[model samples]
Target chain A: MKIGAALCVLLLSVIAVHAAEIATADRKSGFEFMGRDTQAMQTDDTSNPGMLNVLDGGALWERPEGADKKACASCHGDASQRMKGVAARYPAFDATAGQVVDLGQRINLCRRDHQKAPELAYESRDLLALSAFVARQSRGQPIAIADDARSANALMQGRKLFNERMGQLNLSCAICHDDNWGQKLGGTSIPQGHPNGYPLYRLEWQAMGSLQRRLRNCMIGMRAEPFSYGSSEFIALELFLMQRAQGMAMESPAVRP
Target chain B: MPFKVEGDAIQRSLTGQPGDPTEGRRIVISRQTGLCLLCHSGPFPDERFQGTLAPSLAGAGTRWTLGQLRLRLVDGRRLNPDTIMPSYYVLDGVVRVAPSFAAKTILNAAQIEDVVAFLSTLRD
Candidate 1:
């Protein structure tokens, strides 16, 4: 009986440690925190405003452009087949660029390298549209960020940045999202900072936006200088977020209040 | 002139003038200025929203002396290094401050005194 009690305490301690590391069972998507109306908007394609960007992106995929006069479909055939589950493995290390790149950057890289076209400006309508369209293909797929040696350093930096105190507020991402998630902060419930939803529509912005834009908004709210768009720091952070959110289902083009 | 800290408290008033509790309450509840309600709930009945991130401001006077409250407003980090509360009257050691807020503290000395005064009134 004494040994059984000791073993029970030991098992409880182990469970506590695992929970501290973010147990898979405890993971909840930002979608779970939304109201019924917003959830409905994300569910139906016709009612979702983000579908408009996906539609525009579908059109852009067939239209030819650049010096090569090639559309994305010319090389990849159909996005439904070629792009499915593609977003799940993104924020990966790019060998040619010799660094990590997110889905948006990957699209620009393809335009520059394969189609011989100029890169689209960050946060532009066409870029967001194309990204939203591609991400829509992987709506139900789980995130699977690769954890090879090539991306190990970037991943470490991302983890560090997430915990580091910044801005005049001196708040880290972990302080609010990790410690105080589900708690009310001035009438809104704080959410676990997940990256599964990107190129999604925000009610606050009233338009489609990328993960980078959202990160910048948080940094400004913290009163910290935001890292420039397309900076390696942002990519590294994205890489870290994707890895942290590993195995969670993708909800790109998601709706958030 | 720099304010002096003795132990965990500031003995002297920051602006060397008695703070009006009425003005202090205004600053504590204002979103554009103090932002206290963003992370703290206080005794403001008219305010529809209050934060749940920190201790309630109700009965703060019963909890600590006025000098201690003053130190907390000035720089709570001096007491607790891991606190999420901003050092309202501190400027040095902060990084990447936006251009408009570069050299400024979150609250002025007068405002800090006002908040302290308002907080002191919550004894109950």
Candidate 2:
């Protein structure tokens, strides 16, 4: 009887441990949706349209700005080292602000506080470049945002936004990314919709853009009213996506169709 | 979106309702109105990027009656609540729907009839 009780406790602990971990939506990434030419666009640095933004961002990092006349390099010299693994852990809890902020928000905060510069307009070219530059530094690193009590509410809200159906189309993020991933939708493979490649270039956009931009486009496609950029809703949704895509390698500055 | 769900086969229009197949075809592909191509690949072989979530409409005329097609377009949930396909005409029974989009059907009565007409002509 003692042995059986001990074994039962061990098995229950094992189950609990397994339940605690989150899994990637699927094995395939959105990269699988591209054709050979598009794949070539990502693998070949010269051909990768996203490189344009990254290059532009590298310049921005060194250039001084605002009333404080401070450059990003002035404080965090050599982003390759100072900013390494930064993007992977974003949408992190900002205890000071008592809310979650994604990478974009973090950059904006830096600009506002240190540089004394106005916030970069969302989806602007300069913003996209900076975001791409920052995110690319973390490429190949697996995403692992903090999962703690403070983040519980934000994460749950994000999950609700993802799973809850809405709009004239009456669709949710899960319907495509989770329920029917890899299935064809509009002659295009429904991607897992991971944020690994945001601030990535797209053939359709012909320019670099952030994950929030992509999310807004999806909302329009669903025939729903999209929230403005920097809204708490977008932040919450980004937090959830980061969690959903945990362990997936970051692919910033990625090219997409 | 004004919609009524009845246990019996819902027929909002007659089988032989006057509908233009050409107009219906244009509507199905239009991003604003039909938007059907978002989840359904039809006989539009030339059109790029057709969706494949739902059944292909290659031979839809032979697969379903005009009444059946209209019902599906009007209120797909009534037939199958679990269907991911949106109800093009019916607006009620959906929660968390956008306020601006609320009380508005994706397609009007005539448009639904027109789509039914176009789909009927999809005989292989």
Worst 10 residues of 2 chain A by lDDT: A15-24
What are the per-model DockQ values?
A: 0.34, 0.28
CAPRI band for model 2: acceptable
lDDT string for model 1 (A74-102, tens) is 99998999999999899988999888888
| lDDT at residue A68 of model 2 (Cα atoms) | 93
Runs off by more than 4 Å, candidate 1: A1-21
Indicate the TM-score of model 2: 0.86
Each model's TM-score for chain A is 0.91, 0.88
Residue B99, candidate 2: Cα error in Å is 7.4
**How well does candidate 1 score on lDDT at residue A142?**
95
Q: Which candidate is the best by lDDT?
A: 1
Model 1 DockQ, alpha carbons vs. true complex: 0.34
Error of 1 at A80 (Å): 1.1
Residue pairs in clash, model 2:
A186-B49, A186-B50, A186-B51, A187-B50, B1-B103, B1-B104
Clashing pairs for model 1 are none
